[model samples]
Target chain A: MKEKLCSLQEAVATYVHDGDVVAIGGVGRNRAPMALVREVIRQGKKNLHIVGREKGMEFDMLIGAGCVKKVSFALVSLEEFGLAMNFRRKAQAGEIELDEHACNSVITSLRAASMGLPFLPLRGMFGSGVFEVSKNLKEIECPFTGERLAAVRAIKPNVTLIHAHQADKYGNVRIMGSPFEDILKAWAAEKTIVTVEEIIDNDEIRNNPQLTSIPYIYIDAVVHQPKGAWPASCDSYYDSDIEEIKAYAQAIKSPEGFQEYLEQRVLSRRD
Target chain B: MAEYTTAELMAVCLAREISDGDRVLQGLYSPLPMMACLLAKRFHAPNMTYFNTADVIDPEPKKVPFSTAGPALQERAVTYIPLWQTFDLAQRGELDLIFLGAAQVDKHGNTNLSAIGPYEKPKVRLPGGAASAHLCAIMDTVIWIPRHNNRVLVEKVDFITGQGYLSGGDAREKAGIPKGGPRKVVTNLCIMDFEPETKAMRLVSLHPGVSLEQVKEATGFELIIPSEVKETEPPSPEELEFMREIDPKGVRELEFH
Candidate 1:
């Protein structure tokens, strides 16, 4: 085991690489891994793909930092903070491949990945336009239903980055607010990087099993990073810093402003 | 005239309309109307049965957020009814009323949820038909509300989320729908019903203080406003208080949708 103070660059370099599908946990403004994402951006990994329901600063940084090549999201806006200009403009401009979606599609997609099944069977989509949107989506016969169903396929990512409330040095993490579908992402990935706001002893978390969100067995590295979910919340630990989020929103509205943001927070950082 | 945001108006709508005597079902994230149903039951509908044809309807109410439950909702509540049950309820004609929102609706009540742009790749994508398509096929009555304007009340939906007003006379029966579809559309601006022949949405009523032209301006589709259009009744003082105070979290809608 190695113990050393790591910059954001060193921290992100520990998990990500090119051509990886990343499963992220966070909805609206709760439970995100912003610091880790900042590290990923600062390190400049490439050809990344992301899957999730809500797209927060993590998605923004990935795209803005020129690391992401594709994204599949249920809903990727800031909700009330404003629309997602980086993702929206990038998708519209074709800089990144976008799969704009609904819950059934994303959740089914994740489930299929976990089951190692080729497709997911569902009712009510024979003639609907979703058939077209998902035309490229693999279609197959549901083994049990015998009816034709769509397979979301296994989306094993190279890494899954998550921020939670507490963790032991061994990587067992506890998430307080919303887990969104993170456990599946962990199972669907090759490796995981768990960062936490607090670092507790493994024995303590082991004694009380209910507090655990990520069991240590699946985790690769455990990093103690407070305010790790900077733009988002860590639940019982911290709330979203709306002021910083507001500033990020203001910057992403224009390319010039976004570039400035990248330079100031991303490029300027030693990490 | 009050300071009720769009969200508050939606809460009031749920509280006043849904009754305890009737079982209520709603869509997820459909905050205002769902709240309105709870209030209506708490105040009016006393014995109403609640159902969520989509997700598990959690009655405990604390862990689930006011708007929509995250993954944690599964932890607290038992998965109760399947969507087919709501369809069954509508099929048996047991449903007193059901509320839903629409992308676009035309005269004679043809609603679209297919594409926001062309049929190929739409500009905007919404959560596809929940029970709208089937509900239209069998429901005794359905209320369509769109929070936004003109783009929604178009002469045609870039896509149809659900097929509405299949046929006023007997076309629905012939098509296999026991009951005809679509009773009314409650929008942010005003209310509308179907015409006799064309079956297009006719302006039937407006929210309090809304004008005829204002409703007309918001509609992309041509509408027939009845000579005598009424206003949606305002929330009673009691309804307002319950919504703002007791159910501020918007739980009334969460359990059923």
Candidate 2:
């Protein structure tokens, strides 16, 4: 196997391209690939179509930085702090395209891509207005039972970005807790780039093979960055830096403030 | 009656709804419901299976974490169930109850967490509904609206992010939904349930100090008052003590603030 270890900048630069459909791995406020996301912002990648299940700071920051042209998501918000100001602002202003989906639809779509299917049958969202607005979903009657089902189109992203607890140089990853759709995203995407908190020996990963969430075959690149998911919890590693998150939430209230946030928090960082 | 915050009162009321052996799930940004589930597990419904947005199954966290979607929930968790699997459980009909938050809710309990005005050009682009659309259709949903006013309680939602009774009477069934819809709506001011035939929101009970006139004034649509609306029970002293023990930092009050 080719050694996939590389720097965050190189991994993002090489794998993530302009206008590529990028899948974000983590769920809300936990294990987001922030270091990789910041590099994507700093590199000035544009017009990316972002996808995620339940997103938070990473998606909001990407939108605020004007890197995203369209977003396909079930939900994106700052949770307790408030609404994702940038997303709310840009969406209401019609600056970005919103392909709204229910959470299950996104999962089912990704699952379809993972399984190499054109579309997958889903149980719900038939009567809700979300079903009406979602252009990718179709209602189909099951042939065997004549039961109604929503068919969600497969979403095969060009790249999937993930943050995990540990990995080997060859890209065998160990996600400590709650591998929230990261493995599915990896399988669904053409290329998977992982940013891990630590790089361990291959023997350590080999010793406990069952702990390896994403094997080397699926991962295209592995970026080793400690505290990569700062302001977002990494399970056993550390708790979320709520103070910094609050600071970020406070800073992005205005356009100028958002730029300043990008400069000081995102762009200025060297890792 | 013991002195209790509205948050505490709401938590107790929500806990009362959980029955033994019921499989309950709570999504992100939901401290009150989290507290209620924990409270229920500790008190009445020990056999109830609990799930959170953090993907931890039956977590016994020390205290309610500031962010519901974080590592704190993983502490002493029985097992891990990722978002997909949890939704799968709902699809398989194993999930008994779900607590969902709404941005705007209508008389029929149709929720709008999608947008305020229009799909393309929204007046206000609220957070898109995560699993509300799917779960509300498949399983029992207990909606919690932190703020109760004319703006939130509407005649018709601008968009239905979650299907409730749809247009009322046989609408959900006609739409091919097999089971489950919004069961009850719990708000800061009062508790509301759907009328059996019309499926419109009806006044169930008023919270301790809130009045019938106040509820009528706050609601955007005319509510079906049942002539005798009882005052919602205040949180018991034992309940208050246990709630304080669970949430020493008052994390549950953050939503109210």
Candidate 3:
């Protein structure tokens, strides 16, 4: 088996190119690859398009860093804290293109991409006004029943990044809790990078076959970085830093505070 | 008189709306409904199947979850799902009830969670439609508003994130949407229900200290107020105690504040 281990910076630099369409795997605040995302920002890549099913801090941080040009997702709020400040401001300022899709439609697009299909038929958008705005959505009549269905375009991202609980030396990933589109995202993308909380022996993976959510063949690279999902919860490991997130929400409201946050938190990284 | 906070009142009102054996679902930023669904499951509707948006099924968290999407909800789950499966269940019509919040809602029950001002250029770019637009057309949705004011209760939403009763009765059916639609709108001020014939919002009851004039003044559109509107019943002592036990740390306070 090929050795796929790498440093967070090396992994990001090798896989995430500027203007590349990138899909990230996490829901709300669960187990996000913030370390890798921060590194992407540190590399100062521009015009990146982000594909997320559900996100919060990671996307907001990336947007605030002036890295994103377009975003396609169901929702991107800080949950209990408040709205995603940078995402909201940048979008309202017309600095980034917001391709809004319902959470289900985004998932359907990923499913289609994973299945290598052209499009997926869905029933949710029949009468909804979303079709009027989202040009990529089309109303097609089912050939068999003549029923109108929304044909959501497939989402095949150039690269996908995910944070897992554990991975083996050969890159088999074990996601303890709800996989939440991470596996599907990995399958759909052209390249897959995983940031894990721990790098365990292959025997541990072999000993527990059922916990293997992503097989080694699918993963392109693996970076062992504990607390990779910091500020966000990583299931069994730690809970989300609600206070810090709330503080970030308040701090990012002002330009000076946001800059200070970047200086203290992002720019002054030890590793 | 036993005093109750607005959060407790809202959660209790939402709990009553749930029926026995209903397959209910709730998303992120919804603490009231999470508590209500759990309360309903514990007391009135034990058989109610609950989805906590954390992908957990019937999550019996020892403590109140800080956020609905947090991992704490899955502490003692019977089973769980991938986030995609939640939508799959909604699309297949397996989900019976869902709780939603609206940035703006109209008399016709049309809802907007997408943008505040306009689609392309918004005064405030609210979070885009996650599952609101799609789920509302399929399931029996209940709208919850944290604050009730004229801006939120508009005559017509700027963007329709979820289709309530579009124009009126039969409009949803005419538009090829599924039969079930929005059933209620629970807010801090009062509980409102949709009219059977017109599909317009009608004031059912007002919370304690909330006057009829206040509700009327707060609503942007004209409401169908009954001649003898009743005061909303306060939460029972037992329900309040149970809620306290469920959310001992008062996680619901974070939103109301």
Candidate 4:
């Protein structure tokens, strides 16, 4: 088996490129691959197309750092802290292209990619204003039932980034709780880079193979980074750092403050 | 009558929407619905299958977490159901109830959580609606607007993130939605329901101390007020106590602010 373990900087630099389509792991503030995301920003990658369902700070920070030019997502918010200010500001200013979708459509699109299909039929979003702005969605009649369904175009991201609780050197990953679309994302993307809290022995992974969420076949690189999902909870590892998130939210209220935040928190960090 | 905060009253009203065996799902940033679900399960709807954005099934959290998607919800769950599977349940017409917050709501019941001004160039890009489009068509959607004002209760939304009665009577049906749409809209001031004939938002009941003139003044669009409007029942002592028991830190009040 090929040893897929590498440093975070090398993994991101080699796989993630300028203007590549990227899908981030985690939902909201849970198990976000912050370390990998920060590295992508740190490397000064630009014009990347980000895709996800119900993203939060991960997507917001990327947009804040000006790394993203377009986003195809269902929702992006900081939950209780309020709207993702950076996303709201950039979007309001028409700085980023929005391929806004309903959450179901995003899921169906990823599913289509995972299945190697051109598109998948969705049941809802017919009269929704989201159906109006979504350029990739089309109305198709089911051949058998003659039912009108929304056909969501498949989204195959160039690289998928994920954070897992544990993994082996060969990249058999075990996500502790709520593997929110991470598995589907890995299967849909051309390459997948997982940052893990710890890299365990391959024998241990093989001992309990059923616990492995994503097998070595799907993963391209595995970067062992402790506290990879910092500020976000890792489920059974640590709770979300609400104060830090709140402070970050406050810091990004202005464009100058957002840049200052990047300098102090994200850009200043060493790999 | 028992003394209660507006948040407590809203939570109790939302809790009453659940039946014994309804399969309900709560979304992210929904502290009020989270409290309501716990209160319902503990009281009337013990058999209802509760699900959250965290993918936990029938979670028995000791206390409501600050974030609705927190790990506390996963602590004592019966099992796990990924979001796709939950969406599948809604598509299959098995999921009964869901609560969604709206940035703006029209008289036709169409909600906009997308953008305030226009799609191409928005004045304020609100948080995109998560699963509202799909689930609002299939599940019995209960919308909550914490701040009831002219800005929120618009005559027509700029964008329809969630399909309600789409331009009124039979429009939702013509759109080929499988089943279910907006059932009841609970706000801080009053409870509103759709008029059966016109599918327009109609004032049903007002919360205690909230006047008919106040609701009329707050709504941007003309509401179909019936000949008589009832006052919303205040939270009972038992309900208020149970609400405190579930959310002692008053997380339910977070959205109201």
Candidate 5:
């Protein structure tokens, strides 16, 4: 018999662990798993490390909820209107240990891990400041040309929390918008969990097999949550709510404002 | 000749330089030239390929910033391919165009994105470099430096985030990269190309609103502006409307980071 599927809270609860690196999918205010983020807040997750790639809203929510202990990312902005106030304050205050990695390096490391590779050859540090932090890169001589190149270590995640446009009961999912670095993260993670806008039939997926990006076997659990990818646009499904994003940006800057904001939308009103 | 906006200046570069049907790869946040390349594909050559860092290849790429037609973009007729496999395409010399941005671009086309003014404690920290460094050596890359001030176009970048013109294709070969160095450099004020023999940069054309003095003064190094600078074209009525209508939800503003 198939196991019982649960709510967004239960789904995220089952996977997250303290001090674990989790990759979140969404950009600024679009397609982030806000419902589950609320659950993280409710649980009061501690020592959680977040890996963000254009995942502004979810990161802010977790920080607002005091969930993340450390963060590694490229850019953490609230999509255009302004700064990720709460996140910025936390980082500046040394509340969270922040390791600012380059966007391509993070994704490349994840991509290498996803492919089950030990490391990847990288050359993104040519004319930039990112080259400094990456001095740890190991150099090896290439067999083909004998030219030495640096290898960036792989990035493996403890868990992957992805929001998709559609998914099947079997766990195959469709990412309706920009994949960002989601595919690479899926490979790098030990376990993958997803919140999807809709659940479709496996037969439907089989009928049109190519559309699926997240293969079924990799998924540990799939939660059917509508509007799950909020803040981030899900193609034609929905446009991002700008007012909500602005409110989030404002709320994150101040603890009182953020707590009040979260209490009003997420904690006070039940999902 | 009419005065051209920055968008048109970028478009003129692409239309004039990119061959009739060369595969072009552009990364995200590469706005000005990306818009230009897409416009070229729509108007000049349909066979031209378009690839986004998100990994969609030649997608009937949605005009909207966040693509709505994700599934349709991967359909058979679209020649949808793996995004990471793009490196392979460049390795095999299948790419002709690649659009990139630089925080600080020097006379040699070297780019910097490490620190602001100083090495450790800088005035402003910028987002570190992306694949521009790697891609710079692979494809017929085009560098876009939107801010055309001396600080941005310097005599030498503070750090080499991406190489501009390799000593030559010989340096690229020694490095095991099959392709060559950057073919052109696109800026807000003027367009530039390398002096092949010495690998020095030479000015190709200046944007309409920009003057010879402004272009020369803005550059960190002495430039060889052509005797006759052609005016850049203006955005079509359609292009202007599209820029406004889509992603009105602060899509443009969300790019501060």
Candidate 6:
């Protein structure tokens, strides 16, 4: 049994390497592993490929920090607040490659990887132009039905980071509500790092084994960091820091503003 | 004549479209549709199953949260679904009605939530298509646009996220899509539905104070208008009170603003 427990800084330093395709788990402002994401930015890791379903704060921060080179996911907006300014600006500036997929397609790729399959067939991308752009997606005929369907190649990330409500000493991770691709992402990645708001007793995890979203067998590292999903809602813990997200959305509108934001918020926060 | 904001009116009109025991789906950042789902449950469709994009299935939250992913929305959810399951159900054709918003909607009802310009060099990189491509291919889609204008309602979308009728007739079926497609498009100004013959979006009814001329001007392409277009009825006092009760914080006002 490997001792999976560690600090957020150590976990990011050890597992997340440069140019690694890292998947951060969350939907919108929910359960985003922002602490580890900020540490990744602070470490100056470059050319990282990021994957998420509905990426918001984590991806946007990484993109703004110039840490990400490519992104494969659907819809990177702040939901209601507006578009992800950094992601939008950097993507448009050609600074980063945007391999956009339907939200389902992103999950399909993850699900394929998790299932240990070469590719997964789906009918979702049949008519959409996504098939035309996505190099990994090809149109193939179903053997039985002979119907044309989209076959997406498995996307196995080098490492994945997920935020959860609690985890035990042995890293049985439990997410309070709406796992939101974290479990699937963990299963799909080569290495999975979990950041938790609290680290409970192993006995507590054992008593309710079914409640555990990710078992210790899958999780590589468990980082105990309270408010790990700061600014993003942590479900049953605290509400999203909307004012900060809103300010970040507003300030990231310009190059200078974005720079100031990165310096003041991400870079300066050594704690 | 009663006074109600366009958001409330849209909610009321959308609620009317949902029937009893119909399973409804709403996407992220959809406050109006979320309200409509709640209203339908309270009034006509109590047995209806409602699911939000955030994976909150049959949520019975006290107040509608700012985002579907918010904690409030998950206050008393029947179950939690992953993003994968949401699409899985759609593919299996389990979901009946879906409420979606689009950046641009075409005459044929094809939607664009992808980008404003070409894929390579976009003038505006709008949020890329989520599950709209799949949901639109399978289930009955109800599009609600808070802002109605020529730019929003185009002759042809820059890109098709959710396939409406494609090129009309059996185009969707020809593309190997499932039976259902865009059923209605409720906007601030009017409610539009696809013509049975051509699948072109037709002006079904104008909102109160919204003229047919105004709708035509706002629409990018020529619309199929009935000779006798009726005005959308204002939300009744009871309906308004129910809505206000459902949303005490006036969160719906944010969308209109």
Candidate 6 C-alpha lDDT tens digits along A108-158: 889999999988988756566666677878888999989878888889999
The Cα RMSD in angstroms, rounded to one decimal, for candidate 6 relative to the true structure is: 1.3
Candidate 4 chain A minimal-lDDT segment of 10 residues? A124-133
TM-score evaluated only on chain B, model 5:
0.79
lDDT of 6: 0.86
i-RMS, each model, one decimal: 7.0, 0.9, 1.3, 0.9, 5.0, 1.5
Off by over 4 Å in 6: none
Model 3: per-residue Cα lDDT over A4-88, one tens digit each: 9999889898999999999998888888888888888889989999998778988998899899999988889888788898998
lDDT tens readout by residue for model 2, B1-257: 67888898889888888999999998888898899999899888999988998898999988778888778888899888887898999999999999898889999999999899877788999999999888888989999988999999999999999999999998999998859988899999999999999999999999988989999999999999998999899888888888898689898998898
Which parts of model 5 are misplaced by more than 4 Å? A1-4, A26-34, A52-56, A59-104, A122-132, A176-181, A201-212, A242-271, B1-4, B60-63, B66-82, B117-122, B165-178, B197-200, B220-257
Error of 1 at A268 (Å): 2.3
lDDT (tens digit, per residue) of candidate 3 on B147-196: 99999999999998888898887888887785678899998899999888
Q: What tens digits encode model 5's per-residue C-alpha lDDT throughout A209-252?
A: 88988787678788888877665556458776767777777776
Clashes of 5: 17
Q: DockQ, in order, for the candidates?
A: 0.15, 0.88, 0.75, 0.82, 0.22, 0.70
Clashes of 3: 1
Candidate 6 residue-wise lDDT at B224: 96
Top-DockQ structure, candidate number: 2
lDDT, candidate 5, B80-159, per-residue tens: 34445676576567778777677787776777754466644445444445455556655677787667888888887776
Give TM-scores for every candidate, taking all chains together and pairing residue i with residue i: 0.74, 0.99, 0.98, 0.98, 0.80, 0.97
Tens digits of per-residue lDDT for model 2, A92-132:
99899998898989988899999999999999887898898
Instruction: Evaluate all candidate structures by whole-model CA lDDT and list the values in order.
Output: 0.61, 0.91, 0.87, 0.91, 0.65, 0.86
DockQ score for model 3: 0.75
